[model samples]
Target: MPFIDIKVIAGVFTPEEKQKMVEEVSEAVIAVEGEALRPVTHVVITETPSGAWAIGGKALTAEDVQTKRAA
Candidate 1:
């Protein structure tokens, strides 16, 4: 069985949209893997918010950039 893991910004996507995305991704994987093998046994999706997301200890947010631009 093929195991696939997918990650995306959680707060940006609705629950329904997430489900559909997962389904489509899994189907594509299965198509490539072939029906003989079991479908993807595991699927993982992770979501993160822009505010909480950080790079090099600096929290990144759209508002932060917008404020800088306004200055």
Candidate 2:
């Protein structure tokens, strides 16, 4: 079985978008691993809570992103 894990900050994607990502990721895996492994491919997406995902030693929330975008 093939297992894939994807992680991202919360509020970044809607449910439909996440589903699309799963489908597309599975397709990509199938392309690389061949058609036979398509049925066994698994994709897991994890969403970190807002203000919990950090970079550059700073934790960032969805509000921070919105403020930056407005600037």
Candidate 3:
């Protein structure tokens, strides 16, 4: 079985978006690993607490990231 783990800041994506992401990621792996492996390919998406994840030694939440991006 192939295990795929994806981590992201919590609240960064909606439930529907996450589902799409999982499906897309799984499909990508299947394309490379073969169609037979689709049933056995495991994809895990984990969301860490927003402020708990950091960049450049600064802690920030998804909202902060979006606001900054808009600037």
lDDT of 2 by residue, 1-71 (tens): 89999986788677998899999999998999999998789999998899998899999997786677569
Clashes of each: 1, 0, 0
RMSD for each model, in Å, please?
Answer: 5.6, 2.6, 1.8
Q: Between the candidate structures 2 and 3, which one is better when assessed by lDDT?
A: 3
Tell me the tens digit of each residue's lDDT in model 1 across 1-71. Answer: 77777765445556897789778877787777876754445677776666787779998675664566569
Q: Ten-residue segment with the worst summed lDDT in candidate 3?
A: 62-71
Question: Where does model 2 exceed 4 Å of error?
Answer: 64-71
Worst 10 residues of 2 by lDDT: 61-70
Tell me the tens digit of each residue's lDDT in model 3 across 1-71.
Answer: 88999997887788998899999999999999999999999999998898998889999899986687579
Error of 2 at 69 (Å): 8.9
Q: Which residue pairs show collisions in model 3?
A: none
> How do all models score by TM-score?
0.61, 0.82, 0.87
Task: Give the 10-residue window scoring lowest on summed lDDT in candidate 1.
Answer: 5-14
Model 1 / residue 28 / CA error / Å? 0.5
Candidate 1: segments with Cα more than 4 A from true spot: 52-71
> Global lDDT of each model?
0.68, 0.87, 0.90
